[model samples]
Target: MLNSVNRKVFLLYPNLIGYARAALLLLSVFAFHVGLLRFAVGSYAVSQLLDAVDGEVARRLGQCSEFGAALDMIIDRVSTIALYFAIAAKSARAGLLIFLLLLGDVGGHWLFMYTELKLGESHHKNSAHLPPGLKHPTSEAMHQKLMIGGNP
Candidate 1:
């Protein structure tokens, strides 16, 4: 069933796992809306935990594909956005933090992916292959400088 061209794409194990995570995230949003705090937190945590394993499952099973990667990325970003939006709805302090986080996450990932594609590099390679002129730096050096507040 796994190899047959007639087999449904949704039936693939990795894709099925991704769909389950998405469902959990959706439930998390609904739970948060209904003020079921424990349920919301648990669902969201499980979704994220699944995220860490889905890629490995795909790689080990030889199921990796551009479509799978795109699906994973979209689900991850949407989940993060939904989770933070829900938190922001509950607390003003969380709203401020969420605003900053969403801005950096959405904007930074946009630039990062754009540059990665433009440079003909895979997303797995990190920013080490990035050219010097790029503004969105994710290198360890850049992070160290930011952490130290210095020109290193």
Candidate 2:
């Protein structure tokens, strides 16, 4: 059964929002590339706002799913890294810093996701199984304190 793909989650309101976010993110990057900073910023800001809105929309609409959550996560990281690339493109001096930051950003999130998948976490955001230090900065681990049901 092609469960994850067959659920028609691609049409869920939250997932649709995710698609919009992805499109807006691409628009932001392209706008930045084409020397449209204001447009890029506006698009990026809306995407970020939709990031927060998607979860709430999912919760309220009873539309939350692994697919939507995963979509949210993937886009969040991709957009952030894209912004870092934009910054690196502009600041010749901070290229190395951006490189290191993104390296850690991507690496840490990857490790955390790998761990979550190995443990069969239905929700990849859970992190109770990991060591204290392994909680990734870019992942929900940073919000452990603010999140309900997180390890105390």
Candidate 3:
């Protein structure tokens, strides 16, 4: 079913989808701040759906790239952590566990990204078409850059 649709629909508006996802994430945070916990949870779920759909759409449209995937992954991790923290605030025991879990998950993801960058695989796989300027000279360069407060 997905294959039959025109790819242009996805390609023409990836930025719009990204913005919508960001807005939804912001709304979820706002809802939590206002004590509408259920609404916040629902918003977070919707945001996740939007995030997944946008990536799938980008892929279907041949717009997939390592940069986009990395951005999406970072957003997903941050959103999940923020939402979990908000939820945890309502329950002491659950909150502690949630914090620990979030830390582990984020830490693991960071480690994997670090390793991939070191191996020079971060830019070679899904984003081989990236411009020369955007492509890292080598994995070592990427590792050094990342270690020195570079965006990854």
* lDDT (10s digit) by residue, model 1, range 40-149: 99998788777655665776687866667777878878987996798788787786789899998778877877887888765532456756554333334334433543
TM-score of each: 0.72, 0.76, 0.64
Model 2 gets an lDDT of 0.77
Q: Using lDDT, give the best candidate's number.
A: 2
**lDDT for 10 (candidate 1):** 53
Tens digits of lDDT, candidate 2, 10-121: 8999999999999999999999999999999999878877776677678778888878877887897898798899888888999889989889888987787777788886
lDDT minimum window of 10 residues, candidate 2? 143-152
Task: Name the 10 consecutive residues with the lowest summed lDDT in model 3.
Answer: 142-151
Off by over 4 Å in 1: 1-10, 93-96, 125-152
For residues 11-120, write the lDDT of model 3, one tens digit per residue. 44544576677788888898989988788878776776666455556656767555466657767687877867786877777966896889888887777666667767
**Most TM-score-accurate candidate:** 2
Write down the TM-score for model 3: 0.64
Error of 2 at 134 (Å): 13
**Inter-residue clash pairs, candidate 1:** none
**After best superposition, candidate 3 residue 22: deviation in angstroms?**
1.8
